[model samples]
Target: MDFLNYTEGVFATNTSGNDSLETTKLPTSKVLLTVTLSIVAILTTFFNCLVITAIAVTRKLHHPANYLICSLAVTDLLVAVLVMPFSIMYIQMETWIMGKVVCTIWLSVDITCCTCSILHLAAIAIDRYRAITDAVEYSRKRTGARAGAMVAVVWLLSILVSLPPLLWRHFSEEGDLEDQCIIIHHHLAFTLYSTFGAFYIPLLLILILYYKIYKAAQTLYMRREASRASRHSCMTNGSMIPSSFTAGDGDIDGGPRSPDPISPPEKSFSEPSTEEPPREKVRASVKAFKRKTRRPESRSESRRSQLYQGPRISGSRERKAASTLGLIIGAFVICWLPFFVKEVIVNTCGSCSTSVEMADFLTWLGYLNSLINPLIYTIFNEDFKKAFQRLVRCSNYL
Candidate 1:
């Protein structure tokens, strides 16, 4: 297999160029890659920074949902500033020039930031689901302390997961050969850590939470429809009964008075009293008060629902947000999957040489996942867009 050949070449060869590879000195490709990556890095960094600033400054944005968004922004910012620049530099150099210390740091930051980003996304999904599913209950539970604990746990887990690779991995120049970094006797361990800790577990949790949230939203909508129907029925019946009774009383009193000019004293005395106007005025006043009162109450209820139960509209805005997140996550999986697969194939078969160029390309692509997230969020989320625009406008005006 390709893995066997690659491993054999690495173990047996001392030269930089292996038999199974084609070396290139394409300055144009190098420049293009560097320029593109640099531009992406700058934009991503600036965007995420804006996200953090906007959330911090805007009190209305300071909620659990946006708190998680802030966390995500921070993670993306780290990736953009710390990870992406080095990756671009590495690609430009076409070799690991920074010694073992920098390499370890790079690896740690890369894993930690990516892991934290994924975890933050998962947390946001859960928060949104709870807001929609058990809005009242979620509001009561999602206190500052609770949010703090969640953020703390996310960072702690990210650090823990990132530490393992640095602990076991090292780089050394073997004779006159090019210096290469490799995990020491821990390929399987790294695979498991990367797969389960980063991708598989988080994806599973997100899918399940969103599914429940979707069902809960549907139930709430149905209940609202039913309540509206019943209220309309009651109003119709109430108005009809009052009008019919008033008309009947009017007819009976008028008919007797006109027909019997010389009416008996008892017959006149037995006639129903006409105090209906005052009673109707009172009823009308009560209705007017109810209508006025209900307006504010309805508004309050809507705000409450929005605050506790996630977004009000599951329309294009929401779908677009979901799609953006899904796209980033999907890209992450696709880009990183190759690296792991390459590692597994080489470890198991020991046939093909590890394509350093391909591996580097894939790794950088994976890091690019972080850079895309902030852009995705800003594009899909209107609140983020508005805040960003306002911030820009204010800056320009100032």
Candidate 2:
């Protein structure tokens, strides 16, 4: 009996010690999570601020197109400042730190900012597509007022998508219900509505807009290449023409002229010609030959001018912008699709199982999209690139 009691005591002690050690390690993981969240928040704020500053300070970047970009940066900045910190706290604590009112506000801001960010992308894609395919019309119609209206509409739609949750969510007198800030994913109507509006609809629009943009861009490139090939052929044939002329200016008789019917009839007698070349005639012939020789050169210069001053140059710029937009769209989908998919699954399927940690990871991944948007949009832009260089290199001058 004594030996059995001793063994049980040792086992109990070991188990208690192990439990305490595990509890102690929990804070370490929490600290790591906190640090990671802080870093993400800082990066999101810093990069987005850089983009906004670059656009605002750079005079050339102050166009209707970049106005949309600035709006996107603002939305992302809000996510970093207003949404990310709260998100980090919730992730670490596994419960809401603020009260019900603050919780409601936070969720609203979260949805509003993310949805606004996404809508801005769709807006930008639309702008680029129009600019690519109907440049003259888009330039005529694109205005600050229109862009401002677009921004307003984006926020309004975001509010509509987010507000439904606030109506259904309530603070119950049960455990964690009052304290936990959660979107009421269990409500079937709100779930499908929010998910479809906030994600699915925007995704469909982006896909369609980008698809059209891609096709239009491809056609633009094909036309440009065809023009370039024709130009090259012209230049090549021009060079060969001169080479052939140097070999021989075909027969002096001006080759195979049809006989004029008004000429003397076939029976008319022809006198033997003893013609001598005159000095004035020789001078005029020399001048005319010189003009003809220079004519080919002048034509070549004109062709060169046309090659440089045609649709080709503008097409290249359009192609570059299209490629940049493509990259931004691709990155957006990659970052947000997973989180949106998870949200749809959890909300639409009542019996769906999801790990809390996995959900948190997906949420943060979507948040990281906000961080990347500025980098792709601004940094890849030539004007933005020069502006950034100026800002970094000539701060005092500005």
For all candidates in order, the CA lDDT equals: 0.60, 0.68
- Per TM-score, the best of the predicted structures is 2
Best by lDDT: 2
Score every model by TM-score: 0.67, 0.72
Expressed as tens digits, the lDDT of each residue in 1-398 for candidate 1 is: 01111242211323565432423456677688789889988888887888899888766677766777788899889888888887777656555577767766766777788788878867877777666655555667877677778888899987787666555443322212334423333355565665567656877787787667555545554444343334334434443221112111111002211111211222222222466577776676677667766754565464345433433453443464456556645665675556546655665553544555565555566666666666755576667777778898875321
Error of 2 at 81 (Å): 0.5
- Positional deviation of 370 in candidate 1, in angstroms? 1.8
Each prediction's number of clashing residue pairs: 14, 0
Cα shift from native, residue 365, model 1 (Å): 3.0
RMSD, every candidate, angstroms: 15.4, 16.0
**Per-residue CA lDDT of candidate 2, range 148-205, in tens?**
8888888888878766665555443322455466644355565567777777788888
Question: Candidate 1: where is the Cα deviation over 4 Å?
Answer: 1-25, 170-178, 181-186, 233-354, 378-381, 395-398
> How much is 140 displaced in model 1, in angstroms?
1.5
